[model samples]
Structures are given as structure tokens and as C-alpha cells.
Target: MKTEAEIKVAIETYGDMIRRICFLHLKQYADVEDIFQNVFFKYATKREAFDSAEHEKAWLIRVTINACHDFLGSWFKKKAVLTEDFSQFQIDPHSDQGHLLDIVMTLSPKYRDIIYLYYYEGYKIVEIAALLKKNENTIHTRLRRAKQELKEKLGGDYFD
Candidate 1:
């Protein structure tokens, strides 16, 4: 059995990174808490036989990203409306980030995931390619396409 110390170490090291990944996927306050709980639960189950720390961290991140995808698939939510309110935002009041996020949600999954991992998670394009298990060229192309798509949907005048 893995000791509690090992589990504690993983949480301390990668908790926020995992949380950001989960938020990117689930994108709902309630769903986030549920997913967060699920991540730790799964970790405990798997920790019965411990791997190296590097292996464990990578596994945790991979599972968090997959969990988000699974959550989205199971929910079957429709495309986001452009009219959602942004009053809950507390940063860059003049910056219209929420509207941009709404526009991003309307994007194709390929684009949205690339953008989330690259921008929100601060993963380099190369790092993102490794994590998502896609070719470097493919990640580059998708990121370019995702940005172009977002700009078109939001228009140059949005939130300005």
C-alpha cells in the first residue's frame, strides 16, 4: 500500500495545474468541484501500487484532461450562446475576456482544447503536443486555426 506521504506529495506538487486543466474542460463551478473530487479518488485507487514520481504526475495530468473530455461528452450541452452575462468577472474589467471565452466555446473541439492547454495551462506548443499525444505540426496548425476562428467569431470590435 502506498503511504499517505506519497499522495500528499502529489497533491502539493500538481494540484493547481490539475485544477486548471479540469476547469478548462468542465467549465462550470459545480462540475469542477465534482471533477476535482473524482481526480483524487481515482488517484487513491491507482496508488495501491506506486510508480515513480514523474510517472505519477504525468498520469495525474493525463487523467485530469481526459476526465474533462469525458465530462463534456456525457453532458451533451449545446453550443454556447453569445448572450451570456459577464458580471461575475473581476479581472481586467475593460478587457472582455469572458466574451472571448464564450466565443472559444463555440469553436470546434480541436481548436478549443489546443487553446486551453496552450494558453490557460501555460504549456509550450511542444509540451502541449506531448501531453495531448499529437504531432508538433498538428498542434501548431490547430492553434493557428483556433485563434483565427475566435477572432472571426468575436469580431475586432468586441469588448472594446
Candidate 2:
């Protein structure tokens, strides 16, 4: 188990990123909170040592993504009435950023993940492929497709 200070530092550093990933995947605030806690709990209990800060962040991102997917795939999620609570987001729905975010959220999870990691997180395609355990070419293709979709939705001027 990681020391209390270490865990605290980890949470302080990555909490917002994890929450953003959760929100992207789950949409609901309640589910985001649950997955956030679960991801940190896993981090606290993890036995392996990270090679670097980047490695640690990547690990956390992977765990958060997996946890969100698991939570969404649970029987409870399927049975429950899931309502989107965008109020948790600070962006105004009418604003351009908010409008873009809305369109991004409307994408399928795979496209959303690619867009979030590539555009929002500033990760390179190679890094995203490594983080997602996919081929570099696959990440490149998805990113192109996602950008194309976004461009179509937001107009060519937005991408240009």
C-alpha cells in the first residue's frame, strides 16, 4: 500500500483528471464520484512501483477508464434510470466551449475517449495508443475520424 502522504499527493495531482475521465464516460455526477473514489482506492492499494510521474499518471488514467467502463457495464447501471447532470460542469451550455463539449459528449464512447485524450489532455497519438493499449495507427485513424466528425458538427472553420 502507498503511504498516506503519497496517496494524498496522488489524489491532489490527478483528482481533476480522473473526475474528468469519469464524467466523460459516465455523464452523471453520482457515478463520476463513485468511480473517482474507486480509482483512488485502487491507487492506494497498488503494490507496483511506477517508473516515473508520467507512468503513474498513465496508470491512473487506465484504471479510471477501466473502472468507468466496469461501472457502466454493471447490471445496476443497465437497470437504473441514468440522467445526465451537466450542472457539475462549469461551462455554460450556450458558450462555444460548452457547445463543443456537448457535441463531443454526443459521440460514441470510443470517439469521445480519443477526442478527450488527444485534444483535451494534450496527449500525442503515440501516447494515447500506449495509454489505451491500442495500435498507434488505430489511434491515428480514430483521431482523424473524431476530428472529422467534430469538424462536420462544428463546421470546417472550427477545425481550421
Candidate 3:
């Protein structure tokens, strides 16, 4: 069993990161909570040692992503509209940052995941490809395409 201090540290260090990831994939608070707990539960139960903090964070991220996929596959997941109201998920919906997230959440999961990992998590294309088990070229292509789509969705002044 992991020590309490370790668990607490992990939660403190990565809780918001995990929450944001879960929120990106799931809209309903209940679903997000379930997946978020599942990620930590798996973390608590796993007995693997990490080479570094980065490795540990990467493991948690990968597990959290898998947990989101599992939740989506579960029978309990309702097939509701993908773009439900995310006001509660935002820190400040009126702000431009939140507006950007609102736009990002409108994207399909493929684009959303890539964008989050690339931009929010500060992972490079090659690193994202490795983490996601996709070809590096595929990650590059998706990022390029996703940027174009975001630009179109946000109009010409998006990055300005």
C-alpha cells in the first residue's frame, strides 16, 4: 500500500490536471467525479515505482485518459449531447481563457485530447504520439488539422 503522504502529494500535485482532463472528456459532474476517483484509486492500488516525478505524472495522465475511455464505454454513460453546459467547469466563463476552453470543448474527442495534451500539458507532438501510442506523424497531422479547425471555428482573430 502507498503511504498517506505519497497519496496526498500526488493529489495535491496533479489533482487539477486530472480534473481538467476529465472535464475535457466528460461534461456531467457525476461522470467527471467518477473518473477522477477511479484515476486516484488506480494510483493508490498500483505498485509501480517511477524513475522520476515526470514519469509518475505521465503514468497518472495515461491512466486517467484510459479511465475516461472506460467511462465512455460503460453502460452508465448516457448518450446525451456532447456540448452540454460547462459553466460549473470553468473558473470564469466570462474570461477569454474560459471562452477558449468553451471553444475547445466543442471539438471532437480526438482533437480535444490532442489539443489538451499539446497545449495545456505542454507535451511535444512526438511525446504526445508516444504517450497516446500513435505515430508521431499522425500526431503532427492531427495537431495541424486541429489548429486549422480551431482557427475556422474562432474566426481569423483567434490567436491575436
Candidate topping TM-score: 2
**Candidate 1 structure quality by residue, lDDT tens digits, 1-160:** 3458866877888787777666556666566667887887788777355457655766777788788778777734455443555446323435667556667767776777788777775678987788779999999999988887776786764323
Task: State the lDDT of candidate 2 residue by residue for 18-51, as single tens digits.
Answer: 9988888887778888999899989989998999
Q: All candidates' TM-scores?
A: 0.67, 0.92, 0.89
Which residue pairs come into collision in candidate 2? none
Question: 60, model 3: CA deviation in Å?
Answer: 0.7
Model 1 clash pairs are: none
Whose lDDT is higher: candidate 1's or candidate 3's? 3
For model 2 the TM-score comes to 0.92
Error of 2 at 122 (Å): 1.6
**Candidate 1 lDDT for residue 38:** 84
Candidate number that wins on lDDT, 1 or 2: 2
**Residue ranges of candidate 1 with Cα displaced over 4 Å:** 1-9, 48-57, 75-95, 157-160
* lDDT (C-alpha) at residue 113 in model 2: 89
